[model samples]
Target: MADYVIKTNQLSKIYSKNKVVNSVNMHVERGKIYGLLGKNGAGKTTTMCMLLNLTYPSSGEIFLFGKNPKKHSDEIYSKIGSIIETPGFYENLTAYENLKIISKIRGDFDPYTINSVLKMVNLDQHGSKQFKDFSLGMKQRLGIAAAIMHSPELLILDEPINGLDPFGIKEIRDLLKRLSREFGITILISSHILSEIENIADVIGFMDDGVLIEEISKEDLHDRLNKFVEFEVSDIDLALNIFKVLELKENEDFTVSGSTIYLYTHLSLRDKFNALFVNAGIDVGKVNLCEENLEEFFTRFVSNN
Candidate 1:
């Protein structure tokens, strides 16, 4: 069996009469980046909270590092770090001062440790600046630095780049990659931004309306993204008939939805297919050879269920 840093079975949560999070089975391997993605209110945060024991699960089990967290909360927390929503600090405190307080609160740290985490996050030079004077991205870095002060084995972050500019997003992305590559820290991060997740995640799990829909590795996702030809016709049934006469296999070669037919094979024959449709009195509203990109693929995947 693979060594999993975090695992859940039938994990669920209910608020009042509404089920906010349904039975969810999640697997996050050790020393890998796992991106949990969904729209706001998809219960991504709820699930993470349950894993951290901030919120109790209504059903199911959670295992962190192959042991029940409930049985070892002290041992579990010592090795896990997290930032949910915005990380807070005294506005007037300098970056070093804020982290110093965090270190003091934790009751364990050498003076050298503060600078190490800050340097790892690229905030080492900004020590003199107060938290209020720092940029959004800088604040995030400090949050991360605080989370990593003890050098935990696992880091859970929720929307770390939500409002960051492109440059800031890139900064955080690079930092996370470095942590995963250099330190071998397993990370479970949640975000609604599809492009950022695609750029950094080794594996992705998508949730919709509190249900975890699917989880796939980045390689499998790329393999499944096929370039195809899209045909918008006046009639889907007639288009299917024309496809049959042309000896095109159903599903294997083409799929129909409403007035649209997508051909996954023989993409080079788009012109010939258009001619055949026109010859059969089928109104070809538009025929364009199209390729599915990541955004479109994600939308189609999550919305289908």
Candidate 2:
């Protein structure tokens, strides 16, 4: 099989002349969690829908397991499990009964597998509880149980932790990590919870206004938002003159805000910079190292794009 578990090329979805997903190319590598992040109406769900073949793309192609989805949809989808939006279950039925129905529909009914998945998601103890009486977290866990009971090679979850408490969220996070690490399942998860995604995802795809603006690995993204030195000088005008004299490229090398200058490079030459200012008859107040976290970086990226 190809290296990518999921791949899309120039995928587009349009309705009544409005482009919901526009020329989006995405890649989800084997055995890695790819976080699809965006605000509402940013086309995250639509993109997932197209990938799952729930919604036909207006143009372009989708590949699952290295084959075109249109040509191998049945074989491909059978190997993938997904929970998009709220999953439906018989409210009056117990958790076990609900999964039993799903097992029949899946046509690979295995009682032992069902029980194993329920235990995996921490729903085994609550299997006798009626779905109607289950808490939101319990219901979500059941949904996960149903999705994984068949042991699919790939999983696509849209906001799986929506109604979860902090503890529930951590439980699900650890479960996903375990699934990926132990079973070698590739996951494509979409969430507005950037921090959770930052913590769990191996790669991140940022979307905005129906466009895939950037797809970057978590490590590379962190490096791009690395720490920089911020200098608070006494004279703004004289600082600019000094920078010009030193052939420093404005904005490229540093940014100015009132009396503060943010330096993006030459971090190791901090003493040299200070000496230059001292020799140039400029007064430097404070110099501090600063860094932007993922959320701040995402905001800046969205605003810029």
Candidate 3:
């Protein structure tokens, strides 16, 4: 089992009469990507703010590296790096200079760290050009370079792929995955990009209206999201009779599409089911599992919520 680098218990934040984040209990395991997903105005950014100590929660507790930030020394916070909203940069300064300024604040400026992080985020080419001259995607990459300049153990990024094109998005995604896999940095990434999360997240936490509705591993989600095994049989009446003898739970939950009968189970009961049909003078055409994509699966949760 992986150690939890960060954990929250019943965390919440309210503004006047409305709750922006309500009872959001989530965890980020060490060296793993935990994708915090939600719709717009669904409290993902607010929850991330509470985690980073940029915004105070109305009630509840949060632990970073197994200690409360409120009670711990400032040294404890130095291990974290975050890019909550748009990362501010000196438009007059080049990417390297911007990172140099950040490194100076921590009193650990080095050419090696700057070069290493720039290469990690694929921003090594932006040397002398000022920040204003960089494209939106280039700026985002430079922002990430700044975040990791100090070699922090935890990195929290919200909407990290907001402005990037497909190639840029892929580059950022691969960099994040490598960060977790190679450097052992824990990541808490908040984004509505389900496909992006699906590609990298080891664990996924779904937030709805400020509340965490579900938390599941990518492997477990695959089992659940593999909706049903469909079979097309030539005889409907014979198939229905065999289904009755199989004693499937909640018969109404199963559906038939033309000649195909969808059975919602991981185990393939086709051999047994087919034999029963064949003995009963029915022909079975095909049997296959029908799995929904990540977006469709997420929509099912949101609609049900």
Candidate 4:
């Protein structure tokens, strides 16, 4: 019975003959970071656009803070901030100057707010630096500062770390974590960087070919990433029978593949499995711990889907 900050039901967008965004139901819980993961042309951006009311949905509904976005456009959007793709800024203006313009448009202009937000994003010292003179990371940081300057409760970032170096990426990642945990801000971030998303996101939603294929929590995803002990035996059928006798339920505690059985239980049970097989007169050829990381899991899921 947790409250969702953003929810979409059968949200879709079509462009002529192409269904850019198929029916997608997304859920973002309050004060948690939700990662939207997909490869290029997976409709991640389109989905964000619909939520932000930037692009109208072809069919379906969107709710922000429990109210329909179209019905309460200004009131609902005022509580949200977003950066889709590359953020545009007046190249000739200084960082502070650019944010001043945004603050004015937002009608929440405050000098203290500008300074605090710039400092928060590590752009305080660069306030006087022109947008054209800033580095890629600096520009991105400024974009984030502008997004959060009004202190919105929700943030939607599409590949915010797209061009950042390792250090910059880590900085942004830490900032995002702090925003969610400390400030209680809900975030929906889209990225092709599976590792970063895996490290930071509480929940992950995967999109494939414009379809939302799966949505799972980080802990559940780790469990689903195929971590187990694989046992190769001389007699496959006999091993399965032995497993059954041991009360190791198939497709639950173990799975079969040709001449091998993979135990889904922890590796701590390795000794027990070996002893059981050996006592049953089954020649256990090999036993090895196997696991798949997020990147490998994502690739496999996409290919299979």
Per-residue alpha-carbon lDDT of candidate 1 for residues 1-305, written as tens digits (9 for 90 to 100): 88999999999999996888999999999999999989999999999999888999999999999999888989988999899989999999988888889888889856799888888999989877889999999999999999989999999999999999999999999999999999999999999999889999999998888899989999999888768888999878888988898899978988878899989999888999999889889999888767676777888987788
lDDT order, best first, reads 1, 4, 2, 3
RMSD of each: 4.8, 3.7, 3.5, 4.9
Model 3 alpha-carbon drift over 4 Å, by segment: 229-288
Q: Rate the local accuracy (lDDT) of all candidates.
A: 0.91, 0.88, 0.85, 0.90
- How would you encode candidate 4's per-residue C-alpha lDDT over 1-305 as one tens digit per residue? 97899988998999997999999999899999999999989999999988887899999988889988778988998899899989999999998999999999978899999999888888888756789998888888888888899899999999999989998898889889988888899999999999999999999999988999989999899888968898999988878887777788988898888898888875797988788889889999999998988899999998998
Per-candidate total of colliding backbone pairs: 0, 0, 0, 0
On a 0 to 1 TM-score scale, where does candidate 2 land against the true structure? 0.83
Q: Please, what's the RMSD in Å of model 3? A: 3.5
Q: Best by TM-score, which number?
A: 1
What is the per-residue lDDT of model 3 for residues 217-304, given as tens digits with 9 covering 90 to 100?
9999998784777778898766877777666644554677778888875346656766777888888788776788888898898788
| lDDT: worst 10-residue window of model 1 | 287-296
Q: Candidate 3: TM-score?
A: 0.83
After superposing candidate 4 on the true structure, give the runs of residues whose Cα lies further than 4 Å from its correct spot: 228-290
List candidate 2 segments past 4 Å from native. Answer: 229-266, 269-288
Winner on lDDT between 2 and 3 is 2
